[model samples]
Target: MATRTQILIPIGIAAIIIGAAGLISIPKDAKLEQTKFPMGIVKIDGVTLQVQIADTRPLQTRGLMFQEKMPYDQGMLFVFDGEAIRSMWMLNMQFALDVIWFDANGNVVYIQKDAQPCKSAIETATCTFTNGNNAKYVLEVTSGFVDMYDITENSKLEIISI
Candidate 1:
């Protein structure tokens, strides 16, 4: 009942629509691999930091794990699809960090300053820190970032780009 041209055109349009939607829908907990993910930037009151984005499964799971050293003002930002009571740990971590959580509106909701690193996954699991609040983003910066910037709860965040 339909010509080849007519039938193929609708199929092509449907495919494009579905593809675009897929690209727009990244889950909050989805931890994508780092190699394919792009870098982004975050700004605190007057300080800007170069940030690595971890939006998919593998990247989130391996976030800053076993890393050697993070230069000043450099960090990793984890983006989840939705906000929840998120928890983090220092598993296989090489150094301490200040784990900061941001709400959907980019306000600092919780912070775990001076989070100590653990030698093994088993040990780190027992030392998990949770915000007890909903957070769509989590940033891991050098151990003293919080104190250096004087960042605190309800501090505003600026996400430059992703």
Candidate 2:
């Protein structure tokens, strides 16, 4: 029989390896939720939300695709270089969301609410949704946000950042 010291040593090493591997598979939602990103306060109608900025290309591409849950009071804001028709797709998203577009002055230009997750039927080419409107910014919040908060095309936004 192997000595107790030999068995215990192997068990501890195995645990360490397993823990490291588990970190690699941690869901993006959990990691991103904990990350420190530039945050801004957004108000539409009487509702308010704190949002993360996705101004970089990599972050814009990620765009809440892998996240499973977004807090009601928190969201992600996408900033573009100019006002143009920008389309969006629900490729790897795992939860429903509401996408609201804004003009340069932060006025609501268009809205897409309750956009379903396409991770299950991800191979289908029908997952894209767009209003084909010109917008300089996009805000993605939890599902039902538009209806729940009564955010309409004429609603205004007051974004303040520190």
Candidate 3:
């Protein structure tokens, strides 16, 4: 007969495997909260953008992926629980876009202009992943979004989340 430890070890392993699978399995069309956070909008020369806060790990990991298109005045605001370096890839993105990284204080830490969509498994200038390891928030928008609105480093992002 198998020892008690041996039997329990297999059960424990199975439990961990199941939990891991659940954590990694986020639906492509997961319907997260659609409510908008109440905060001052940042207008780059009066071009307004509606930002939706993604303050959870599941939401952050899904960062604009599998979206067919983004509305002209709409964008996603990825919020982290704490300050940590983060990076973004253009994998599964269907359109050319831009990513603006922000710090915990909502200051623009970095920006990648016109990030091209990845059409294949290979990385290219337009399709490659950009690292914003110093960023806390990653804002995804259409190509030429920043220049079109004249947004720059000094721009501030208002956060109304506690």
Candidate 4:
């Protein structure tokens, strides 16, 4: 009886391992719609920018975390549900980026260019821009995107998220 029990235990363990392996085979399709949001086109200094609006918690928390690259003329617009002292950081960013803050009037209130990605020994807050006040939206783009597009203070940022 003891010998039979030992053999059964090994077989059970093998079966469990096989079951776990099957469980791990779940398909992983890239959730492209996860990044797509109600967006609009806005021209800054005659350059058009395609943007995705983010106005919810999930949208705000996942702000461009896994994106491999953003086009020079494209960006992600983070729309806050309410007015606040908005700030941004580059935690999982693979490349440098620029953050532009907009006030309630849809005007560019602050622009932080060439934002450095987070490093083990480096702090991003040191390089962050805190010039925005009661901002309602934040825009993220590639490094030097603002300068390349000539986006500056008083630049109009149209939103179709409403």
Candidate 5:
């Protein structure tokens, strides 16, 4: 017959080995690479920006989630099929952002400035979602981008290339 201690000792060691292996396999920061998405060029209020186009549902869902930070001259542009009440959240975001919604004609319909990130589990579960006013496109940039370039509801977005 086997002793309880003999069986327990091996189980404990196996647990520790499994735990360490799990930790080693996990990435410290799985930052989203820009090259994974198609690139676009857009201009808003005379400020030109290089943007990542999130045109598909999968790409839109993963927008800026794990990125540590973004340059002031760069942004993510969400393209939809038609104008509607689009919504966005900051779940898993690493930094704050300024979100802008545009109509089909490229006219700004709504803007959320300095939208904060949701870090903890509770915060992520309760993260607030911002909605647009019948918008066909959405743009997300570094927190201060809107104020820095004086982007307003009257501002228009020009897609130089996509």
Candidate 6:
């Protein structure tokens, strides 16, 4: 029979090995900086939202993809050079969203609520696209946000910062 000391020694070594393996298996992106994107504050009616600014093409292209979920008070804002027709897709998204399009003067041009994610390859290939006309900015938030906040086409966006 193994002595208690010998048994405990092996068990502790095994535990350490398992812990190291688990840490190693964690994705590198999991440790990415929380402040990777520039932050801004926006308001609709009287409600406020803290948003990640996606002003660059690369940032806009990667908007909200691969993320697990967004906080209720947080969103992503896409900024464009000028007001025009804008389009968005939901490929590789992990959750549904509510998208709002705002024109240059902060007027809500259009709204797309509860846009579903496309997780699989087939879904990605056939993903639905949401578009709005004369939109200079696009804001994406968690699903049901429009109804919760009573956001409408007439709602105006107060861009506190960008």
* Cα lDDT, model 6, residue 113: 92
- Provide C-alpha RMSD values for all models, in order: 15.2, 12.7, 10.1, 12.9, 10.2, 13.6
List residue ranges in candidate 6 displaced over 4 A: 1-35
By lDDT, the best candidate is 5
Model 6 scores a TM of: 0.75
What candidate 5 gets wrong by more than 4 Å, as runs, is 1-35
Off by over 4 Å in 1: 1-37
Candidate 2 residue-wise lDDT, 104-133, digit = tens: 898988898888766433232455677777
On TM-score, the leading prediction is 5
Question: Each model's number of backbone clashes?
Answer: 9, 0, 0, 0, 0, 0
What TM-score goes with each of the models?
0.75, 0.72, 0.64, 0.68, 0.76, 0.75
Which residues of candidate 3, in runs, are more than 4 Å off? 1-47, 122-128, 160-162
In candidate 6 the C-alpha lDDT for residue 46 amounts to 76
Q: Rate the local accuracy (lDDT) of all candidates.
A: 0.78, 0.75, 0.66, 0.69, 0.82, 0.81
Please report how far candidate 5 places residue 162 from its true position, in Å. Answer: 1.0
Better of 4 and 6 by TM-score: 6
Tens-digit per-residue lDDT, 8-89, candidate 1? 9997777666544533443433423324446898897767988989887667766776578898688899999999988886
- Which wins on TM-score, candidate 3 or candidate 4? 4
Kindly list the per-residue Cα lDDT of model 3 for residues 105-159, writing each as its tens digit.
7788788888887664333233545564577777778887888777788877765
Tell me how candidate 3 scores on lDDT. Answer: 0.66
Cα deviation at 58, candidate 3, in Å, is 2.1
Q: Which prediction has more favorable lDDT, 1 or 6? A: 6
Which sequence of candidate numbers ranks them by lDDT, best first?
5, 6, 1, 2, 4, 3
